[model samples]
Target chain A: MKQQQQAFALPPGAPSIDAMIAAENRRARKRLWTALAFMAPAIGFVAIFLLLPVFFNLYASLTQWAKFSGLNQFAGLANYQRLASNPKFYDATWNTLIWVGVSFVLPATIGLSLAMLVRGVKGEETFKSIFFLPRMFSATAVGVVWYYVYANEGIINSGLRAVGLGDLANRWLYESHLATPAMIVTHIWQQVGLMMVLLLIGLNALPSEPMEAAKVDGASRSQIFRHIVLPLLMPTLIMVTTVSVLAGFTSFDLVWVMGRDFPNRSTLTLSVNQYWESFRAGYWAYGSAIAVVLGVIAMSISWSLGALQHRLDKR
Target chain B: MQKKLSKLLAAVALGVTFTTAAASADPVTVFHDKPFYQSGWDGLTATAKKDGIDLNFSAYATDQFQAYIQSSLMSGDAPQAFTWWNGTKLKEIVDSGQLAPLDDLWAKKIASGEYDASSAAPFTVDGHIYGMPTGLNRWVVLYNKALFEKAGIAKAPATWEELIAAADKLKAAGTTPFNATIQDGWRGFVWFQELLLRTNPEAYAALNQGKLKYTDEPVQNVFKIWTDFYQKGYFTDATSQEEPLDFARGKAGMYLFGDWVIGLVEKGGVKAGTDFGAFIMPNVDPSLPNAVIVEGAPIVITKAGMENPDVVKFTDWYMSENAMNSWATDPGLYAGNLKAKTPNPIIAELAKIAADGKYTSVTRYWEASPSEIVLPAVEEFNRFMTNPSEEQAQKAMANIEAIASQYWASKQ
Candidate 1:
């Protein structure tokens, strides 16, 4: 060992720069393999569970699948044609759009306002915990609670009656014009807490230097937020908005639990309608077509948002 | 060494013997949707054991039960027997070739006068019986007797005019006259069927068979009556608690439901024939024949199950008077077996009404119509019930017709 070291060692008694560079390369290649080895199971699962089923579902949408007729009897876009003619599909699509539009306005706005209000306020953690409490409950449980709140003789009606506004105390979830909006409010009640927590994390992580600089330059609080903080918090905002949009598009549990029997199907988003057709009606192929349509709409919006996120990241 | 090896061999042989015996002792399983009938299932299982047949029973929620049974049948992993709805629903399953015909068993039971021959009609498809009646239920008006007394109604309504007068009295007495709900998404059809069948039973049957359009006059007249009832403030709010709750709590005066609801109503602390009593709804048109809607729940055997001789034997025994008594009598079910009498006073009274009047048995709308149409039609009906204006009724009727026309056109 001493003879080899004497033969190979630099005159300074350390490894040569060339040898160190080669060693660094070897370590990086080993890391690449190790990281891949660690990631292989997750990659395999995504391929099998996620991608495979999506492709199968896509194929199924083109068939004439029914409970009695069974599967694999392809009718070549007949299901889609039927869905196109069906008025309920249009109604569901309209409801989903309304939900998506509301998500863009409600959850994020409310969450951001609460985040900004409680950022450095007294008992901040307590307020945050209180706001985040609804997030801890499952969507179905929230639905059940909210169901009674909007019930005919429930809290809202009782409150209205107590104030001598009995005329205004309508069946909140029974009316077609009110049911979808009522369910959306319920969904947001459960959803905004998560949005608040997420935005709070983003706000807390924000670097203070830009805001300090803006303040010293005589910028107002609103100006600082609009110019410096907002620009810096774009990534989190994008993530939160994207998540909200997807949740809105796929709103099911609340509508199912609360407004499943809404006379006009006023609470039916595309997701709930898809479940109704598939499981309840047993029109499997028609349901698959609806799912495909929903997936396409959600995917396109997400893809556009992702592209915008990528461009912002580059900036 | 030889002795030790022999001991080890004996232990392995003994383990195999026990394993084989355990495997062979597995019970034959039956899946059912009625979770409420635990006592009846227990009694049936006890009786089955006397024939040396070990039976295992499983129950599923009504909403998910059909999907479970259908998927199981398709995958060929279904239990030997399952309870299902008869009529177009059974025909759909029979058409799928998953159900086994029980014609021989039906013939034997009918011949012995244990089961009524006419009861098999709903379960028959293409000249083959595909199911056996778990119970027979006749749709009737189960009224809150206390509410009726408060309204000063001496007896049940025997005519359409008397029914209206009773409704007015009940409404005047500060109660909703009828317990109507779209709860469970299926009860919306109750009032619609009751009105239509009472007016013209033939039209109702034809409407379900798709031979009569929903836009036809008879259907429109039915909706007209339904709308008038709503206008008079006779119905409990559609969003209120489900049946028996509204009916038993005296929130509503009359409940139009099947006789089978006696069990559930009793559970709500209402004594049958005392707090509540049933009446066969009066005909809307005096010239119309006496009719009562029949809802029969049937136990269907899979074709693979029929291959087992023991399952076939068990099925034959299941249709007998003894099995009917074991399963149905205590539960207050209206058993299809003519000889088996239910002990529940309300069911017994309803059964007597049907027998004495010899009412025409019209299939319930839920089971009479094709499922594809019924599922969506119920939603539309609920919509109409919510806003029972003439305009909304027309829209609802048009929507139902759109669905029915499509389904019928496709069949053609």
Candidate 2:
């Protein structure tokens, strides 16, 4: 490090990030570029599987394909136009809105509460392990387990009957209005640990200096959290929010697993409908349209959330 | 001791290697759709192998086959033949020039009064045949004998009013009368078919074809009965919760399902005769005897497979003397061959039901809809199950019409 510093002198003002990063790594920029060149295989994989497909899907939504005959025709805006008029397109949009929003808000809030409780608690590790165990299981398995718990004659109903409230018990996932909420609660339970873990990482990264300053200044715990420490934790919050939003938006396995054939199909997000319409029902053109809309909505939502978080982080 | 240990180790190693090598021979690439049927298929594979066919038996859940069958047909290395449904689904495959019409080969047998060509009717289009029907299904309302006995009901309800009253009696006795699982749009379709048959059986064919609009009153009647039953709690949370089969298994009073359900019931360790009895889902018009819809599967020989002498021989033998008896053993299914009959007593009851005169026959809605309409209608059916207010149901139906107009009109 000292050898690199002898060759490089900083400008008078605070060094830019590029300069510091460049200073940290003493290699020439060309060698760095060569290192990136060596990483071309991984970059190619991301381009093919992720970026190229996304771009192709964007193109497909604008076009049309018959399920049986395959894609040779291009329908342009007509697919999107039909989507706007389709009620299920709207149903999926509403469900997506609910799912993504709850997916972020519920898990984040639970995580915050959990992290706050665990930080000062004894056996923090044990609580975190207990809460996070479900995260290790696939969402599909979690969904099935919960389905049994919430079934008519399953654990929940059995408890209700034991307490002489059997008449009051009804199918939790049966009623469409309640179905979405029920699924969301199960999601939040399974997801809270992740939120807690991410926040704990951020909490651990907190420097003692700023927190001690707030304490000495006669600020309460909440005040310290609201001001100096929270401000310092802004980047972590943004990252957590960004990941949660993406996971929430693309969550097909949980919803599909929970409500395999749930009534009104209103519990259906754009992904589920896209699959059923294309695969089960053989409406590839319409399904492709749904998929495109879903992709747009998901990308836009994540981008917007991340931008908001970044602005707050900058503050 | 060391010498004995080495001898035992050497012998164990030799046994495993020999077994592994023998077990790893070429598989007979069978693309079956029913794993339930595949239990019996394990028996028939020997017959398949006798003609030098390697056993690569592959099976899919019913839904996956519906999605991938087209692609399978186009692939050059597709399975020799698969268990495809014997209806508009099969007809579509044959039309694509992908499926080989087995008519020319099966013709002599059809003429000689061996194969029931009538059962092959759904697999026929332009008078060309595609495959044989495996299960002769007769849709009926199966009731629990214990539930009926507990309710003091001596016989299966013979009329619509009686059935409703029977349901009411069971409800009073604290049991859900109907075992319905409508989380799938198709379950709601059961009541829809039942109501349609009871009210307006004659209108079914037109309804199946593009000739009938979904908004027609007869179709509306199907949903009305569905809504009414749903509101009454005649069914306990079938639409939202799964395991309606569990409801039947757990002794929910009655189930309006096909004969395929017998295998499921049996798997649940429920006795066929003692646990349940079959009767047509009665409609109020006692004068008009009720009918049940028959949905079935068939074997489609690829056109290219026709040129191969070995494939033709396999097909010929598969259609011959003892194969029908072989296929019937598992669930005791009635074969497409007129010469075959099930020995099972439960299936014998369905056989009697099939002989009734006023049968309102139409292909399944998924197969019958003009290509684009199926998905939208599925959505409509799904939306309806949510206990959507009348307004939402109307919106759903209207959207279905729009899909119909948008897709079907273009085709015409």
Candidate 3:
């Protein structure tokens, strides 16, 4: 009765302010629901394909499940324990660190240096394409090409012989010391392009005012870059480093193709070793253990790098 | 009119679907690693069809066959039958009790005198027949006859000295005497095995069983012999980029491989008997009867596949003399079936001699050695072959020995 009296008490031609507010709230809610409906498919896809599989992989890594076996024993930490004592596991992990270090440090630095040097050059795009050409090639192709280059009588030896350095024409992939380095060189060749491209974009987007101020204060190019450009490019550096690090951990094809038949088994990486252990050796659980460790190392590195990048970017 | 038309169309559609289903089910799935084992697989399938068999033959390349088999078997989606190496490979599944026992089938055939005695013993393990033996009983020197004749060497080499002489002659004739796929790390072991076969067969088996030391005198001799050949320029220093396909294509005078050489020769589009012929490696000692290294691949049936009643019928049909003969007589394959008539006279001679109790089939170390050890060791062997100094050879042997000892100790 009171609501009816208020409505009746309202004069004709007067706007209803309370009703307007309520209608606006209802429109906002409807828009929000519509936006959610629009995003539903993408959310569903991510949950199904990416997020769910990661959890499934985690579950798989903890079990003694094989393709045919119905048995999925909940083997908590047994895989980890076995990994601790496994000699090949230790070797692979050590090699993976070396690979990660090379992939993370060498590629990013070289690619960055090249990008910085070429960023101001004439025909920079052409040079960029040349450097990035290898990135387009499959890691297998990179391995094969490098394998030939390092072969006993291949181009390296052929060049060495032309200069009367035939004694230096030793086995590159087969030598105990040279195998990992050979694989590293191949990785660098395959990786440097992406780094250069990422950093170039960051460098191109750098604000000019700080660099201009540094120049006005009689700072040299290196000083200006050190003080202004690099400080600003920290986010990109972290990004390149993080990407390279993850790639190093996940690297399989180059190591597989280049170090496939090395005399010393020292070149075996976690990925390669895991593959052989599972498929060839039929030690499925143990191989899965190696993969889990690799995943952990990758995740830790990626997470820390992401956090670092975030902090620096915010600052 | 519309109703009648719809009824007729629906009837036709139903008929088409049922026939397609029937056609797909009509095929007997036979998985093979040797697609190029005959002239064309289509021709081979046609010939099999003539024998009243509808073989839906799926062939894999040499490299792809294992993973294909594993996926098919492990998924319980295998073709009714398939092929792989025997011993360790077969034992992987056989030991799991997944393989069907064919002992009864063998016994029935033997009682009827339908199967040869010598062929049965090698595939027999723990008195249970896991599979049928499907390879030539030995490794032989497959030499180009025309190349040999051009080099003025009359007949194949008969002894170690003669082999050296023939090799030297072939070298003198400007041909790579021995074909080695050095880049294909696994193929490098051919030299090792051949040397072992010449020097000591027992030691070879012991090495394969991980009983002999990798750096032992016999094993060292194997490497020493290989390096000596390399040092003498009998092999290439950097053929790691080359595969056996390249080796075959390059037209080397001789390729040391097993029974499937005949098919490879056919695939090469060359005359088998005239252009190339294979013979057992010459006896190192005249006092001892010449023995050939036997590598048998067994066709083992899986339990999951066996569960299918249709699959059982196919397996039963597989062991029939007709099916065996079809594979054996086609392109003259050295089949596992002892009773199957072989078109290859040379293999027939050896098969008969083995059956008559004159020749002994030395089991292949390749088939016996665990793959984990073998695969790595071969890579090392390939590496050493590239350098091939006495020190490198010894060190490689030591590495192999360590892995072997560790593996055997674990097995114990």
The local lDDT score (0 to 100) that residue A262 gets in candidate 2 is 74
Prediction RMSDs, each to the true structure: 4.9, 7.9, 5.9
Two-chain DockQ for model 3 = 0.25
How far out, in Å, is residue A190 in model 3?
2.6
Encode model 3's per-residue lDDT on B1-412: one tens digit a residue.
9999999999999999999977777666667786655533454456557866666667776545665666566665665567767767667656545567778767776776657756666667677777765565567777778788888889888777888898899889887787765554466677788788778877877887777888888887777778888788776444456533433454567777776655545565565666677767775655665677777776666766667666666555565666667667556476556767765655666677667776668766667788768876776777677677888888888877877888889889
> Which candidate model has the greater lDDT, 2 or 3?
3
lDDT tens digits, residue span A81-152, model 2: 877877667888888788888776778777878898998689999988988888898999988898877777
Per-residue alpha-carbon lDDT of candidate 1 for residues B1-412, written as tens digits (9 for 90 to 100): 9999999999999999999987876677788888788888888899888867777789987758877876776676877788988888888888777788989888888899776677887787899988888778888898888899989999999998999999999999898998888876778889888888888888988898889999999999998888888888988888775567767778889989888888877777788888888888999778888888889888989888998876877887787777777887454566777787675877776666655657778888999999889887898898887777999999989988988999999899
Instruction: Give candidate 1 misplaced runs (Cα > 4 Å).
Output: A1-44, B1-15, B36-53, B61-63, B111-113, B313-317, B320-334, B337-343, B353-357
Report the lDDT tens digits of candidate 2 across residue range B169-248: 99888888888666545555666556776777666667666666677777766767777777787875554444435645
| Tens digit per residue, CA lDDT, model 1, A76-148 | 9899998998878999999999999998779998999999998899999999999889989989899888888
Q: What is the lDDT of residue A12 in candidate 1?
A: 79
Off by over 4 Å in 3: A1-87, A117-125, A159-170, B1-26, B31-54, B57-79, B102-122, B132-137, B144-152, B168-177, B206-234, B243-254, B261-276, B304-358, B409-412
Q: Cα lDDT for residue B297, model 1?
A: 87
DockQ winner: 1
Q: What is the C-alpha lDDT of each candidate?
A: 0.85, 0.71, 0.74
